[model samples]
Target: MADLDHSSDDTSVDSREESSQDSKLEFSEDEETLVALMYNLIGERWSLIAGRIPGRTAEEIEKYWTSRYSTVSE
Candidate 1:
């Protein structure tokens, strides 16, 4: 009775939902500065920082920091 093999339709729908949530990040100069400041203050506590920045998810902030800055020193 369990005939639910991985359906392409389900995959496509899930992908669409994820893509919608992960929209392009349009961070202003102030936001970048704030992120840097917040990182320096809290140190990797992304969720707390994201709370201060409107419309930004913790994942986005982490991704931006990783892409822009080197974490080799830490």
Candidate 2:
């Protein structure tokens, strides 16, 4: 109760760099190229690429490409 005066106003920040310990990368240049090639080769059948690339889902890949198109057009 005695130190309650400064308790609310005291600010502390813990800073630490966050590094991803992920073994798999989401989108590398090579992966992008391969995804594109797979898309063309399969034509909307993203499962082919998703199956080859670990930790990648066909739905997420499609969403990413769709978002890219929207961003580029805008």
Evaluate all candidate structures by whole-model CA lDDT and list the values in order: 0.83, 0.63
Candidate 2: where are CA atoms >4 Å away? Answer: 1-26, 70-74
- Report the number of clashing residue pairs per model: 0, 0
RMSD of each: 4.3, 8.1
Best candidate per TM-score, number? 1
In candidate 1 the C-alpha lDDT for residue 4 amounts to 56
Find the candidate with the highest lDDT and give its number: 1
- Checking candidate 1 for backbone clashes, the offending pairs are none
User: How well is each residue in 1-74 modelled by candidate 2, as lDDT tens digits?
Assistant: 75775564453211111222122334788778877888778877767778877778877677656654455642
lDDT of 1 by residue, 1-74 (tens): 23455576688889997886555355789999999999999999989999999888898888778777876774
Model 1: residues with Cα > 4 Å off, grouped in runs: 1-25, 71-74
lDDT score at residue 8, model 2, on the 0-100 scale: 42
